[model samples]
Structure formats: C-alpha cells, structure tokens
Target: MMLSELSRFGLDPFLKMRHMQDDMNRLLSGLGTATAQAFPPINLWLGENSVVVTAELPGLSCDDVDVTVREDTLTLQGKREPKVEGENAAWHRRERAYGSFSRSVQLPFRVDPDQVQARFADGRLEIELQRPEADRPKKIQIKAA
Candidate 1:
C-alpha cells in the first residue's frame, strides 16, 4: 500500500510531520525574523488627483505612530508596547508582535507635502496625499491643420 493511502486509515505518517512543522514555526515566530510579515498592513488607493492610504493598527494610538511624506515616498513608523502581565503569570501562546516598525511606500507621482493630511481613529490611520500641480498631467490643445 502507498504511504499516502495510510491517511484513509487515520494512520498518516505525514500528520506527525505536519504537527512538528507547526511547532517549529510557532517557536521560531517569536524570534522577530525577517520572514515574519510586516505589522499594521496597509491599503493604498490612487485617484486622479490624490492618493489615499489606510493602515490597520489594532493596539496602537495616534501618539504611537508617525506619518511622513517626502516628494514621492510615504513613510509610516510606529511602535507597539508589550502588555504588562503579573509576575506570576505564565504564557502558553503569544502570536502578536511588538516593538518598532517602519514601512515606506513609493507613490506613483510626486505629492505636495503641504497638502498631505492624516487622521487616526479607532486604531486605524488614514492619510490623503494630493499630487503636486507641477507633477500632474497637463492637457495640450491640438491645432487645426
């Protein structure tokens, strides 16, 4: 009988391997390695005149985050503090990540730094960036032959 057929009898050898892999992944996730995903994932939208960005920051407040726009790049930097627990408390599982994180995105066009606006509410951040007048496309009139 094939090894794959053992799954039908509830004796799959691969099941043990899968459980070991999960255990290893959980143990290594706490190391804060580059393989981990970026915190506070973001969504970006580009419009004819402006760009909008929204980021999910579940445990962060406005004071913890900083937004900056320079020419064609937008940077989001923030820190999440670990929750304090009692001295006798023991942890069985911890998946949430804490510490400083910075994410920078390059915009499609140059933005007017003065026209940038940001708002943070309900653990979410929204930023609006207006394209610079000089960087916007201009319509040229066609001459009749």
Candidate 2:
C-alpha cells in the first residue's frame, strides 16, 4: 500500500518525519543566535488614583533599561546585549533574544509626571504612575428635592 493509505490505518509515517524535520530545524537554528520581538511583553493595571505597568525583560539589568513618562503615556526602552564567550567556545543553543526594544502605553488617566515611580527587580520592571486629583473617581450623592 502507498504511504498516503497509511493515514486511514492511524499510522501516518509522514507526520512523524515532519515532526523530526521540525526538531532538526530548531536544533540547527538555535546556535549562538537570538530571537527578537518588536516590544517586550507588558501588563498594566489601574487603581483608584494610580496606574501600574509591569514589563518582562529577562536577561537585562537596571543599567540597560530606561523608562519615560509623559502626561498620559509611558514608554519603556531596554537593551539586551549578548554575552561574550571564549574564542574557542561553541554555542549549542541560544534561544534568548539580544537587542533593543521599546514599548509605549497610553494611560487611562492623566498622570502626575512628578509622582511617577519605577523599579526593576528579578528581570521585571514595575512602574507606578500617580494620576492627577482631577482624574480620580469621585462618588456623588443624590438629595431629595
């Protein structure tokens, strides 16, 4: 019988071969190379009078990161430089990315630029933005006429 007919019997040899080929491709491609993204992944949260932003930036230190805040927007910029190894050393795999990335986010409220705070720890960056008093939510009470 032909290989195509084997699919009917739940024994697809071609699929196995394709999976093997993909594995080989990945193994060959991960040699002292880096993958890059247009922007690093980030998470944002809003509080009553504050907005928080967190970004994932593995393999980078504080010195390599920069944060900028505008009236209602925040920007994160960072660089991940590749490591230097011995001249005789050969890399078997290098999946981590090494390059510069910038991400900008528009906040829901106008922030007090003077009250912005940023901290980086354990490969993550956390930014705290304080909103202006005018933008904070206010409760209204109704009176009987």
lDDT of 1 by residue, 1-145 (tens): 7876787777878777999999999888879666767667999999998999999999899999999889899999989999999999999999999999999989888999999999999998999999989888899999999
**RMSD per model, one decimal:** 9.3, 10.3
Model 2 lDDT-worst window of ten: 30-39
Per-model TM-score, in order, reads: 0.75, 0.67
In model 1, where is the ten-residue run with the lowest total lDDT? 31-40
Root mean square deviation (Cα) for candidate 1: 9.3
TM-score of 2: 0.67
RMSD of 2: 10.3
Backbone clashes, each candidate? 0, 0
Extract clashing residue pairs from model 2: none
Tell me model 2's lDDT, rounded to 2 decimals: 0.85
